[model samples]
Target: MTDYVSTTPGLFPLPDWAKEDLSDLKGHQKGDLIGGDEDGEIAAAYEEARGEVIDRQREAGIDRIAEGQLRWDDMLAHPLAVHDAVETRGIVRYYDNNNFYREPVVSGDLDFSGDVASELEAASDRVEEGLQAVLPGPYSLADLATDEHYGDEAEFLAAIADFLAGEAEAFPDHETLFLLEPSLVESPPEDGEDERASEAIDEVASATDSEVVVQPYWGALEEKVYAHLLDADVDAVGFDFVSDREDNVYNLQEYGAPGSISLGLADGQNTLVEEPETIRERVEWIDDQLPVSAFETVYLTTNTETFYLPYAKFEAKLEALGEAAELAEVKAA
Candidate 1:
């Protein structure tokens, strides 16, 4: 049986064809793409794009695949930013990167509007292998958005958590649910916030039968934050081994890794192609550093979204990751 799994955190780069189709819809409000005259055309493009992404992952021998999230123009904030109850505000810097996303401002009562669920359902129809669904974690969503309706921060966070839970419950076919939580690393929880954050994550995780992986990329998690994450009601925890390998290793050695851990070995932002041998060597090093049986299942993936790189480079990374996983499997055997 395969003890290790290979997958991505989702959000692949849009193919050229899809980009061309969406060109006309650029600058228009996200809601327009949902039900406007061009909606059918856009949906068809997304379907074609999903098929292409699935083909690439299958060709590269990826064990688990994602829906590619071709329609998520606002990155991880799409589920909330595109909702009818939320209004898109001015552009804001996305975490420490050069990329930006329109800020989501809560204008009315938050509820599940089915935008994300519809995307997942469409993509699921195209994928043949185990499908993984990706979404922004509640803590990260709350941090990225501006709350206008709910006056209290805690109340707003709880509401977002509930909304995410509803979304997760809608997708019962997903094999894995990746909750991307970059805010935990970008803005570490203060004092008592750790418990609150854990509870929020648990709220979302509890609603899904699929395995939940709380993946925080960009950098290593603070010691306190990592401790809190270990207590979260998720199946796996993903760490950014590419951006901050030293810190990640230190944390694993000192505090110990979760029973199920995903290591982001591929760098998603850079255009430089990595050698399969080099990636295999890094995986072996990580395996050697950790205590025996520290992790039950080790998932291999990119540290962040692959949308930052061009399609060619992204494909190369996928091939490299697959080759590395094969090598690691052979070594283990």
Candidate 2:
């Protein structure tokens, strides 16, 4: 018998109540609240919305729950863009997606203000257990940002890593911490750069007692990059099975994954959700191909953030994943 778990992305489509609240205000943006935010109404709205999503995850029989990143305009760049040390510049395209986020230009050294930790704290108050925190991986954050503070490339990467490490240290107790690193695929590291990226990830991993999952999406990483990721000390590494399954499978077969690996079986970008049986079959097939003990824990997860999808579709996809994981476990037993 195999052990599996189902988890969705941190960024999700806003709930109707939260949407209504935001729209009622004239100057409201993603995180900006309407009505002048005098009484922290928008902040409260995010918490209430987070509670609604937590309930949705429970209703769908999902395992770990997230706070939905409702306050974040974009998961990767929003924290830095809002941080005091960085200045928000023009919006930049998020990877190859149609969505864009305000770019954070680094003009000074980074200061960790427990921004992510505060999100987890709010989420912890809502859910009793199995809470997961997701954040932008150091490499991806650095890659996406405009760094003018550190002249040397390695210095910049290290500074970003240390900054994120501070953020991880302050996080409340949680089940899992997902570090999303889409830049590994968007701006694949140059020769010998993957190792440095891995080091940066490890720096963050070391700060948390919770299992840290380094997930690179949009596409499979290059073979060498994948190897470096596997060697990293994180508890697990994740792959995007939706976009380029063939290349991902080849990497897993060629290099063999670590003891714990996450599989992005659901397509987050699309509106159509697959049947449970189809997802079950895909999981079983991949499991059979991996070497014995290749994975002790396989996380069935979203290929990317579900912020692009409608709320109903996102909930349906989560329901399917929970059912699919159960089916696969039963079949393996």
Candidates in order, TM-scores: namely 0.94, 0.95
The TM-score measured for candidate 1 stands at 0.94
Task: State which candidate has the highest TM-score.
Answer: 2
Compared with the true structure, what per-residue lDDT tens digits does model 1 show for residues 98-140?
A: 7778888998988877777887888778775588889899999
Show model 2 residue runs off by greater than 4 Å. 26-39, 291-294
lDDT of 2 at 127: 77
Clashing pairs for model 2 are: none
Provide the global lDDT of candidate 1 against the true structure. Answer: 0.82
Cα deviation of 257 in candidate 2 (Å)? 1.5
